[model samples]
Target: MQLHDFYLSGNCYKVRLFLGLIAQPAELVNVDLPRGAQKRPEFLALNPRGQVPVLVDDGQPLVDSQAILVYLARRYADTHWHPQDAFSQGQIAGWLSLTANEIHNGVARARVGLKFGRPVDLEDAQARGRQVLELVNAHLANRSWLVGEQPTIADVAVYPYLAMAEEGGLELAPYPHLNSWIARIRALPGYVDLPRF
Candidate 1:
């Protein structure tokens, strides 16, 4: 197995975090984003979208962070990480969708703008991030995990950007429940720390 990765990318970090949690070993192939290596012909062949966090398992390329997370959990992790029941699977899928859409557009995009200097409205992104955080904070107020009792890919998928929201100039101080949730995730076994900004 191998992963095309970018060190500063939260999407890439999600895959790495899961790999660590499951103790799966894979080669890390760094894509030179600053040099536009993702747009290169070789990289584009792996993912036409030119994104990182592409996992190649048994020579089969899997694109998108959420897709990669689902694949990893289902293929490698125990049932606890990704339940097999219909309703549970659907609930997890919903969170994955939220990670791809709301989390991406809000927290991740804000970080891209503020930390990476992307051409985005930082204030708008941060404001959107706050709204998303508010929703998540309320959702987590009475629950330890997103879907059920134990942690799932939903937590892994949404964690990175929210953990690093400070880089996006978004303060997490207002969300005590969310902050505790972050701490809970960090306390999980096999938890690996991503590079801090």
Candidate 2:
């Protein structure tokens, strides 16, 4: 397996973190996003989307960080990371949707704007981020994990952007439950830290 990665990308970090959690070995191929390497023809052959964190497993390419997380959980991890039952899968799906939509548009977008100088409404993004954070903090108030009593891909999918919220000018101080959840994830066996801004 080989992961086309960009170190500063929270999306890319998702794959790296999951691989560490499962103790899976994958060759790391750093994509020079700052130099437009991902858009080059050779790299586009792997993923036309021109995105980093494309995972090549046994010569098959997987695009999108969330998709890669799903693939890794299903192929390399135990059911604890991605349960098999329909209801549980549906529940996890909701969080994944939130990760892709709210989290991406909110916290992730804010980070991209502030850290990478991408044009975006920082105030709007931060507002949306706080809204999503409040929801997650409340949901986590009584549960150790998102989907069940154990960690899942849902947690992996949402953790990166939220954990890196400071780079987006969003603070975690108001959400103690969310902070605790992040700490719990950090303490998990085989966990890897994402680069802080």
**Model 2, residue 172: displacement in angstroms?**
0.4
Per-model clash counts, in order, read: 0, 0
**Model 1 regions more than 4 Å off:** none
lDDT of 2 by residue, 36-128 (tens): 999999999999989888999888999999899999999999989999999999999999999999999999999999999999999999999
Cα lDDT tens digits, model 1, 1-197, are 99999999999998999889888889999999999999999999999999897899999999999999889898999888899999889999999988888888889999998888879977788888999899999999999999999999989998989999888888999999999999999998888897665
**CA RMSD for every model?**
0.9, 0.8
lDDT of the candidates, in the order given: 0.91, 0.93
List candidate 2 stretches off by more than 4 Å.
Answer: none
